[model samples]
Structure formats: structure tokens, C-alpha cells
Target: MIDSHCHITDKRYNADEVVSTFAEDGLEAVVTIGYDTATSIEAVRLAEKHERVFASVGIHPNEFTHEDSLDGILPLLSHPKVVAYGEIGLDYYWDEPERDVQKRKFIEQIELAISARLPIIIHSRDCDGDMLPILKSYAPRITDGLVMHCFSSSEELAKEYAKLGFYISFAGPITFKNAKKGDIIRAVPDDLILAETDCPYLTPMPHRGKLNYPAYVRYTIEKLAEERGVDFEYMERLTTVNAKKLFKKIVDFTGEKI
Candidate 1:
């Protein structure tokens, strides 16, 4: 299976240890993401050292005030293992950089992804009011498609993203006891549904309080299959295919650099 989004570079887990355990954990490949310039570079380093690991380089919304500029991130995308441009989008929950700054950075990265011909992995939270419109405006240029990472928004907004041909990626939150978005899970088309662990953060049930890794992504997959009334293996294969479809730089299970 493919972990469409995660942060193996978070410093909580040994990057080498995590990357080495992908196969042992039943992961075919992993897209270790970046939220800032440092983590982005660490992601690229991990991708370089491990064949089954790939990187996504971008500045997070909260880091808008940081000195790191788009120019600093642009060079990293040239790395063969870099798959997408993001985990970049607006986040009003923390509201760290102000809405305007988040929107400006988000659009700047969107333009970069468009010009680079790379898919975008989005991280929208509570800012859907503005996020949806900005995404819609760039729909024409986002041929590589966009993925709503760790989606837990309303069905109405989910449909809006779907209309733009954007894929919805579900994480550990779906396995929570209070979760009520089963219909949303069922609503996503088979080809557009993706899975992730969002490791070290949204750890799935049975392991909810502990640290998460790529291996634990299976729990999220199992819950999704149960929710959607599909077989476990079928959900695994479907999400793997969907992940590759969106992050085209993933050449194969071997994670060869493109």
C-alpha cells in the first residue's frame, strides 16, 4: 500500500528506522511530506537514502512569516524523488500567519506546482471558505490533480472539491469514536479515494495514543474498507492505484526516482 501523505521527517522517529520499516510494515511506498524548508530538505534526504520513500516540498501556512522563500523551496523540487508540491494551504485553526499571508503563499505554491508539472497535496483546515475558491480558480492549471490531505470537512464542501477533480485523502481521524463521516467516505469515487497515516499525529485506533508510522496506515485502510463495505485488500489496491494516479512521480513500488 502507498501512504499518500506523512511526515517521516518530524524528528520524533528515526528517519532511517522509519524508511527501513516500510516493507516490514506492509507499506509498498511512502510520500514523506514537508511543511517548512528544514523538514522539506530532511524529506528529500530520506527519499534519497531509501528507495521506497519520496518527498513533497512546500512551506506550510503557519510558516508564512519565516525567512524561507519560494526560491529556497524551488531548488529542492528538482530532486528526482520529490513527488508533489505541498501540504500547503490555508489553516485558520491556528491562524498563525494571518489569512492573507496564507492565501498568498498558497497561491504562490500553486503557481509553482503548475509550472513544475507536479501534483499538489493540500492541507486545508477551517479555511475552506477561502480555500475552495482559490482551489477552483487554479483548477484549470492543476492538471496533475490535488489531494485534500486528512480531510474531515462537511460533505457539501467535499463535493465542491470533487467537482474540481480533486482527490480526498482520509487519515486516522476517520477511525475516531466520534467520527460520523462514513457517508463522505462512501461518497468519494473509487478512483479518487486515498489513504494516509499522517504519522506521529493522527494515529489510528488501538494505537491512537502512541506514535504512528507507515506500518500503522493499515488500520486506517481497514477502517475505510469497513466503512465503504469493501474488502480490505480491495481498498488497499484501490488507494495504491489512486495515490499513483495523483502523485505520478511515484514510478513503482520500488520508489525509483523519476
Candidate 2:
């Protein structure tokens, strides 16, 4: 299985050791996401050393600052292991500034994602109205594609994203009791589904509150398999296929070159 979104670069996770040990998690590939220039650089650097890890670079909504530059993000895409761009998007549920700043930064990041021509891993929260315009504007410009990371919406919202041909990525929240994400997952087409840890934040059930590791994603995979009522192997294959398409770096670095 693969973890399509995770902040392995976060200091709380002790990224240096975790990145080295990720392969032992039985993961074929993992995307170590970025929320700023420092973490973006860290993401790519970690991907460079580990075959099972890949990188996505972009800033977060809450991190928005007038001083933030598109150049802070653009250069990371040059790295061979950098398969995607972001962890970037609007988040109104938490600390929020004026709507204008949030909108401006989100668009700027998407524009960078377009220039880089890489998939964007979005962290949208409680600002769908504000976030929708940014996504709708550039639906056609990028080649790498897009994923709604740790999605926490409904079937209707899922269908909206599905129309854009975006993938719906599920994290530990999906496995939580009475999760509000059930309809969202149910609505996603099989091929458009992916899994994530969003590690150091939303650890999957059975290990909730523990420091998340890539290996713990196994629990999430099992939970999803049950949700879909399919065998575990089938779920694993489907997600790997999904990941390979969006994060092509994995197909190049994963496993022995048969």
C-alpha cells in the first residue's frame, strides 16, 4: 500500500529517522508533503535518499505571509523525487486572516503548481466556497493532477471534485468511529481513491493519538477494505495503481527494476 499524503518532514515526527525507516513499513511509496519553503526543501531532500519516499512542495493557508514568494516553491520541482506540489489550500476552520489574503496565497500556490505542472495535494477545510474558485480556475492547466488530502466532506462534494478528475485521499479520520467522511468515501470512484496518513496529525484508528508511522497505514488500509467489502489484496492493488498515476516518481524508484 501507499501513503499519498504525510508530513514526514515535520519536526514532531523526527523526520530524519522516520524517512530512513519508511521502507520497513512495507510501503511502496510515500509523499512527504510541504507546508512552507523550509519543509518543502526538507521534503525533496528526504525523497532523494529514500526510494520509498517522494516529495510534494507548497505552503499552507495558515502559513500565508506577504513575504512568501512563488520562488520559494518553484525550485523544488526540479528535484527528481519531487512528484507533486502542496499541502497548500484554504483553511477557515482554524486561524484565518482576511478572506483576501487567504484567497491570494491559495491562487499563488496553484499557479506555481501549474507552472511546475505537478499534482497538488490540497488541505481544504471549512472554506469550500472560497476554495472552489481557486480550483475551478485552473482545472485544465496542470499535468501532474490533484488530490484532496484528508478529505472531510460529503458525497456531493466528492462528486464535485470527481468532475475535475481529482482524487479523494482518506486519512485516519475515515477509520474513526462514526466518521462523518463515510459518504465522501462512498461517493468516490474506485480509481479516484487514495490513502494517506497525514502523519503526526491524524493517526489511524487502533493507534489513534500515537505518533503515526507509515506502517500504521496498514490499519487504515484494512479499514478501507472492510468499508468497500473487498479483499485486502484488491484494495492494496487499487491504491498502488492510483498512487502510481499521480506520483509517477514511485514507479521509477520503487522495487527492483524488473
Candidate 3:
């Protein structure tokens, strides 16, 4: 199993301890994502020290400031442990309502991802109005790949993204009793479905209200398996395979690079 997206870089958790517990949680790789330059650097630091941890560096929509530069981020892509270019995209929920600014930064990062030949981890929210069209416009440039992190969109939108070749990642919210998107999970094809912890946030049910850790992903895996009515091992194999397919830099259990 693997956590396609997480933030072990967050001050809330001990990075070393989290990396050490990955195996016990049945996780093979954990992508410690960043939302800005500072967090991006922290993510790389974690990835550099832990073989099981990989990193994705980018500025989240809300983190985009005039001073931030894509040039600074481009260099990190060469790191062996750096797997992707994001957690970047539009977020209307925040005070950063400048759509043009968000779009420009997102496109710049998309270009960087293309140049680096790495997939992008998207962090879209409350911007469905323009998310699909913007993604559609840039679909040609996203050659490596992309994923909708902690996706909370409708099944219809999910299908649209699937058609655009974007992988759909589900997090803890899927396990919430109020979550009405089980149909969305069932709707996604096995090959494009992925799972994530999005830790220190979106912790899965039964463990909700507590700080999330990568190990808690098992509960999500269990929930997804139950939703699909498949065996736990089957769901695990499916998501792991899907994650490896997108984040090609991830290594296998034998230390063989994928």
C-alpha cells in the first residue's frame, strides 16, 4: 500500500517517527506534499532522509504570493526522492479570490512539471466552476500526469476528470457517515482510483477528530474496500498499483526502483 498524498512536513507530527511507522501501517511509500517554498523544502528534507518517503513541491493556491518563484522550485525536481510537482491548483474557499493569479501560477507549475517529466498533485477545492475547463485547456501540457487530491467533487465531475486522464484520489472524508459520494468511488475505474491520508487533516472515520497519520490510511482502505464490496487485499493491490503508475519514481519493497 502507499499514501499518494500527505504532509509529514507539518509541525504537528514528528517526521522521523512517521516514516518509521510506514511499514507497520503496510505503506510502501508516502508522498510528503508541500504547499509553499518553505514546506516544499521541508518535504525534500524528509524525502532525502527516508527511503520510503517521496516529495512533491509546489505552492498551493492560497500560498501563492508575489514573492514566490517557479524558478526556485524547478531545481528540486532533480532530487531522486522528488516525485511530483504539486498540491497546486485553484481554491476558491480561501481569501485568494484572484482567479487570474491562481491560473497563471498553476499554468507555470504545469509547465514546470512537463519540463521535469513529473506528475502533478492537484489541490482543487470549491472552484469546480472553472477547474475542469482550466484542466482541460492544459491537459495537453500535463504529459506526465495529474491527480485530484482529496477529491470532493460530484460523480459527474469525477467522470469528466477521468476522461481527461486525471487520477482521482480519495481521502478520509469518503469514510464520513455524511459522505454521499460512495457512488463516486464505485464510479471510478479501478485503474485510475487512488487513496491518500492527507495527514494531520482529513483523518479517516473512527479515528476522525484526531491528528491523521499515514497508518490511519488502512481504515480508509478498509472503508473503500467495503464500499466496493471487494476484498481488502484487492483494494490495496489496486490502489498501490494505481499510485505506482502515476508516481513512477516510487521504489518497490525489494528496493528496486519502479
Candidate 4:
């Protein structure tokens, strides 16, 4: 299995220890996301030190500010370990940075991602009303790939994104008792679905309230299999295939055929 998105750069966990356990955890690879320049650099460094780890770089909506520029981030994209361009997108759930500013930065990064020819990892919260149209408009140019990371949206929204050929990645939240994501999980086409841990946050059940790590991604996959009425092994293989397809750099980096 592959953890399609996570933040091993987050201070709560030791990055080296996390990567070391990939084999025992049953993870084929994991893409650690960057929400700002500092973490983005760290993500690349980690990916450089670990073969099974990969990285994505871009400013997240909540982390963006007027003075923040993608100048530092742009260089990181050239790194062989950097497989995608974001955890970038809108977040109206927060009250700072203003919605328009987030939107502007989001577009700028999207254009950057397109030019760089890398897949984009998105994070949208309470802003899908605006998020959908923007993604639709850029779908043609986003030929590299795209994924709605840690998705906890409606079934209709999931289908809409799938229509655009964008992947829908589910995180630990899908394992919650009241998640009510069965339909949403089933709604995603097998080829368009992916799984993640989003570690140090949103840990899955049986370990939900504790610190999360990539290994725990198995719980999310288990929940996905349950909802879709497939076995765990099938769900695992399906997500791993979908993840490698979307993040093609993983194939280029490891010379692993999908």
C-alpha cells in the first residue's frame, strides 16, 4: 500500500523513524506534503534520504500570506524526489489571509504546477463551492495529474472530481464511527481512489485519538474496503495502483512498473 499524502515533516513525529518502518508497516511508498517553503525543503531532504518516501511542495491556503511567494518552492520542484506540486488549495474554515488572497495564490501555484509538469495535491475545506469551478477550468492544463487530498466532502463533489480525472484520496477520518462516508467511498471509481494517513493528525479508529503515522494508514484502507464491499488486499492493491498512476514520478524515481 501507499500513503498518498502525509506530513512527516510535522514536528510531532521523528521523520527518520517513520520512514524506517515503511516495510514493516506494509507501505510501498508515502508522499509527504509541504504546506510552506520550510517544510517543503524538509520534505525533499527526507525523500532524498529515504527511497520509499516521496515529496510534494506548495503553500497551503491556511499557510499562505501576502508576502509569501513560490520562488523558494519552485526550485524544490526540480528535485527528483519531488513528485507533485501541492497540498495547495482553499480553506474557508480559517478566517485569516482573506478568501480572495487564498484564491489568487491557489491559481498562481496551479499555473506553476502545470508548467512544472507535476501532479497537484489539493486540500479543500468548506470552499468546494468555489473550488470545483477553478479545478474544472484548469483540468485540461492539469495533464500531469491531480488529487483531492484527505477528502471529506459530499458524494456529488467526489463524482464531480472523478469526472475531471482527478483522484480522490481518503485519510483517517473515513474510519471514524460517524464518518458516514460509505456512499462517498463507494462512489469513487476504483481507479480514481487513493488512501492516506495524514499522520500526526486524523489518526484512524483503534488508534484514532493518538498520534498517527504511515503504518496506521492500513486502518483507512480497511475502512475503504469495508465500505466498498471488497477485501483489504484488494483495496490495498487498488489504492497502490491508483497512487502510482497519479504520482508517476514514483515510477520514474524507483523504476517500478505500475
Candidate 5:
């Protein structure tokens, strides 16, 4: 299985130790996301040090500041281990960064990702009304692809994104007792479905309240299989295939057959 999105550089966890456990946990690979320039560099460092870990770099909406520039992050995309260009998008849930600033930065980064020929990993929250239109406009330009990370939106929105040729990644929320995301999980075409842990945030069921790690992504994948009415092994293979399809650098860098 592959954790399509995670934050191994979050400081709350020992990044080295987390990567060390990938073999025993059965994780084929993981894409550690960067929410800012500093974390982006750290993500690349980890990816450079470990064969199974890949990296995505971008400034998250919440991390956006008037003076923030993608200059630092732009260069990281050239690294062979850098597979995608985000964790960037709108987050209206937070009141600190003005909504307009978030939108402007999101667009700038999307254009940058396109120019770099890298897929983008989005983080949308409470701003789908605006997010949908923005993504639709750039869907054609984003030939490298994009994914709605840790998606927690409605079934209709999920389908809308799939129609745009974007992948939909499910995280721990899908494993919650009352999530009722079976329909959402099934809505995504198998080829566009992905899974993630988004640790150390949304820890999956049986360990929901605890600290999360990439190894726990299996729980999310198992729940995805249950929701899609497939066996665990099939779902695992399906997600791994989808992840590799969207993040082509994984296969290129590691020469992984999966």
C-alpha cells in the first residue's frame, strides 16, 4: 500500500523512525507533503535519504503570507524526489489569512505546478464553493494531474472533481464510525482513487484519538476496500496503481514496478 499524502516532517514525530517502519508496516511508498518552504526542504531531505519516501512541495493556504514567495519552493520541484507540488489550496476554516490572499496564492502555485509539469496535492476546507470553480478553470492546464487530499466533501463535489480528471484521496475520516463515506468512496473511479494517512492529524479508527503515522494508512485503505465492496488486497493494489499513475515520479525515481 502507499500513503498518498502525509507530513513526516511535522516535528511532532521522528521522521527517520517513521520511514524506518515502512518495511514492517507493508507500505510500498509514501509522499510526504510540504505546507511551507522549510518543511518542503525537510521533505526533500527525507526523500533523498529514503528510497520509499517521496516529496511534494508548496505553501499551504493557511501558511500563506503577503511576503511569502514560491521562490524557495520553486527550486525544490527540480529535485528528482519531488513528485508533486502541493498541499496548497483554500482553507476558509481559518480566519487568519484573508480569503482573497489564499485564492491568489493558490492560483499562483497552480500555475507554477503546471509550468513545472508536476501534479498538485490540494487541501480544501469549507471553501468548496469557490474551490470548485477555480479548479475547473485550471483542470485543462493541469495535465500533470491533481488530487483533492484527505477529501471530506459531499458526494456531488467528489464526482465533480473526478469528472475534471482529478484523483480523490481518502484518509482516516473514511474509517470513522459515522463517516458514511461509502457512497463517496464508490463515486470515485477506481483509476482515480487514492489513500493517505495525513498524519499526525486524522488518525484512523481503532486509533482515532491518538497520534497518526504513515504506517496506519493501512486502516484507511482497509476501510476503503470495505466501502468499495472489494477485498483488502485488491483495494491495496488499486490505490497503489492510482497513486503511481498520478505521481509519476515515484515510478521514475524508484523504478518501482507497481
Candidate 6:
């Protein structure tokens, strides 16, 4: 299965066996996130060496102090397996510093992603303005490849993104009993839905407190299948097809031949 959004490059999961073993199951690939200049650089490095790992290049909202942060990001886009730009977006949850900087950094990364013509994995948390406007502002440049990674918004917002032609990517949060994430799974159109682990962070239940890895996505798929009332294999196929449609390059990297 495709883990549409994850952080394999995060030091927390960089172990050789941990990284290699996680994918031996149904796990196809993990998207390595570029959280800063240094990490963005490392992400591409991992993607280049590992066939099952792809890269997303961008600075996290909390990791930037200057526009120059894009310096390292721009060069990494040409890497063969670097497929997208982000984990970059507003996050009042991560840093309460100032809204302006977060907005600026978000916009800058959007501009860069647009220029590169790559999909952008997004993360927005508790910003004051309506989420759609923030997402819409970059619509002109995103080229229809924007993924709302680990989306935790309301069903209203999920429908809004579906209307905007953006993909709504869900994660382990959806498996939580009271998360209302179940509503999102039901509300999102099957064509517009995608799945992710966002590993090292939103690990699914039974392993909630442990470090997340790609193998655990099966648990999420099981939960999604139950929520949607479809068989597990059908849901897995739908997510796999949806992911390939969005990322596109996984077909090439893994020779998936789907």
C-alpha cells in the first residue's frame, strides 16, 4: 500500500533494519519529509539510495527564519526520487510565535512548489483564518497536486477540498474511536480519498504510543474499510490507485506496473 505522507528521513526512524523491515509487508514506500535545509537535503539522499523511499522537499513552518531557507530546497527538487514539496504549511500548534511568519513561509513554499510543478504535502493547524482561503490562495500555482496531508479538519473542510480538486489524505488519527476521523472517511469521496501514516507521529491504535512505521498502515486500512463498509482489499486497492494517481512516480520507482 502507498503511505502517501510519512517521514522516513526523520532521525527517529532512520535505522537500517527499521526502515528496510517496515516495507517488507504491504508497505510500498514512505515519503521522506524535508523539515529544514539540512533535513531536506538528507531526504533526497535517502530517496536516491532507497527504491522504496521517495522525497518531499520543503522547510517546516517552524524551521524557517529567512526566505533564504529555500536555498537548499530549490537544488534538491531535481533529485530523481524527490516527488513533492512539503509538510510545509501554517502550524499554530507547533509554534505560537507569530502568524505572519508562518503565512509568509507557507506562501514561499507554495511559490517554490508551483515553479517546480510538483505536488505539495500540506500541514495546517489552528490558524485564525478560514482554511479554504489559505489553501485556495495557492491554487493558482499548485497545479492540482496539493495533498492535505494528515488532514484533521472537519467534514465541511474535507468537502471544501474535494470541491477545490485537492486530495484529502487521512492518517492514523482516523482510527481513534472518538476522533470524528471516521466521519471524514465516510464524507470524502472515494476518488478524492488517500491514506498515510505520517509516521513517527500519528501512529495508529494498538501501537499508539510507539514509534510509527509504514507496516502499521494496514491497521488504518482495516479501520477505513470498516468505516466505509467496504471489504479491506477493496479499500486498499482504492487507496493504492488514488496514491499512484497523485504521486505518479511510485509506479516508476517500484516498477509497480499497476
Clashes of 5: 0
Who wins the lDDT comparison? 5
Spell out the clash pairs found in candidate 3: 87-121
Tens-place lDDT digits, model 6, residues 66-169: 43457777788867788888978888876544778888778877888878878888887876364578787767656738888888888888888888789888
lDDT of each: 0.87, 0.80, 0.86, 0.90, 0.91, 0.78
Number of clashing pairs per prediction, in order? 0, 0, 1, 0, 0, 0
Candidate 5 wrongly placed segments (more than 4 Å)? none
Q: Give candidate 2 misplaced runs (Cα > 4 Å).
A: 255-258
Q: How well does candidate 4 score on lDDT at residue 96?
A: 79
Candidate 2 per-residue lDDT over residues 15-63, each given as its tens digit: 7688666556677778888888888888888888777778888888887
Which has the better lDDT: candidate 1, or candidate 4? 4
Candidate 5 structure quality by residue, lDDT tens digits, 200-239: 8999998989999998889998998988889999999999
Which runs of model 4 end up more than 4 angstroms from their true locations? none
- Measured on C-alpha atoms, candidate 1 has an lDDT of 0.87
Best-to-worst order by lDDT is: 5, 4, 1, 3, 2, 6
* Model 3, TM vs. native: 0.95
Cα lDDT over the full model 4: 0.90
> How many residue pairs clash in model 2?
0
For candidate 1, list the clashing residue pairs, or say none: none
TM-score against truth, every candidate = 0.96, 0.93, 0.95, 0.97, 0.97, 0.93
Q: Which stretches of candidate 1 lie over 4 Å from their true place?
A: 252-258
Lowest lDDT block of 10, candidate 1: 249-258
For each candidate, C-alpha RMSD in Å?
2.1, 2.0, 1.8, 1.2, 1.1, 1.9
